[model samples]
Target: MARLNVKPTRMELANLKDRLKLSTRGHKLLKDKQDELMRQFIILIKENNALREEVERELTDSMKEFVIAKSLINELFIEELFVGSETNVELDIHEKNIMSVIVPQMDFNIKEADVTSDIQYGYLNSSSELDEAIERIESILPKLLKLSEIEKTCQLMADEIEKTRRRVNALEYRMIPQLQETIRYIQMKLEENERSSIVRMMKVKDMGTNN
Candidate 1:
């Protein structure tokens, strides 16, 4: 059973009334917050859907290109050209905040392995097509990483929206009603006590007059 902490006296009742007013105001603000969160969540879902489709398409294309590149590299006779050269690849990535969302930031440097100045076997690189393919791969990598971050952020926001909605619903459908009920009960009890006191006082006065 829920009870309001209303005082037996008028002074306490006045204080309780003020508290009820504040509680109502807080409830309204929380409800508004919940609504705003839900709206944002819906928007994010739409954006995420579009992003997902784009990322899938791009990744599919990238994978196809990757297979072709791999096959070409394997068939290339670059053993003499790559001799004594070292391959050094470095990737530095970090997260940055944007509108409470964390997105990926990346910097990458790639050094060809065993790149010899000899051109005898360098003919294996037959044309700049492989160079272009590698550049595209590098370019698409960051985009994929960014999409991953965005998708994760969308999920996180969705979870937060769900939690906020639950709280709002509880306050609207349960807590507020219970509080109002308790207040009503307290008011009724107080009124009954006042009436009983009045009756007792009247009876005592009548007995004294008769004496």
Candidate 2:
């Protein structure tokens, strides 16, 4: 590795050694964070997949039932039956940190949240299929929200892992090696200077004895 372009002095060597120690420690910590983040990300990905599958499957079934019910009833009457059924959904959004990366957390509450509370039509105007379909759709709402949170968390963690990998690579491949090489070069220069000083002193002593 290439040594740093620094003066070959004892003070510079000490400074380089201190930097190397900090770099090594920081590298290890970043590496560990990357590993743990990967583990958590993998688990979240699996859960996201499973939850997505479940939500999609239920949504598909409910849509089929809804289509059948629509065909069985007059279109305009269907609209009339379910009119003025709007309810406010309160969303509580916040963040949580994982390995120093912030990810989203969301909680929601539907006003007066009984799944069938909005069914205002009389029994004579609706079929079993329509009621069941609406109920199923309502029931899956929370799961859909949860699935969104997991997917978003996975995305954030993936980004964090990539960043940590880059930092670890920088310290491992560049900074640490440069410091070590510089330290060795300075030590060699110091040793050479000590030898030259000893030789000069010995010559002076020999000349003095001859005089």
What does the lDDT read for residue 115 in candidate 1? 52
RMSD of 1: 4.9
lDDT of 2 by residue, 1-211 (tens): 8889999899998999999999999999999998999999999999999999999999999989888887886677678656634556788999898889999989988664344444456656777787787778778888988998899999889888999999999999999999888999999999999999999999999999999
lDDT on C-alpha atoms for all candidate structures: 0.66, 0.86
Per-residue CA lDDT of model 1 for 70-111, tens digit only, reads 566644443532353455656787876543435455666665
lDDT of 1 at 198: 100
| Global fold similarity of model 2 (TM-score) | 0.87
Screening candidate 1 with a backbone cut-off below 3 angstroms (N, C-alpha, C), the clashing residue pairs are 85-114, 86-114, 87-113
Quick one: best lDDT, which candidate? 2
Candidate 1, run of 10 with poorest lDDT? 76-85
lDDT of 1 at 199: 100
TM-score of each: 0.68, 0.87
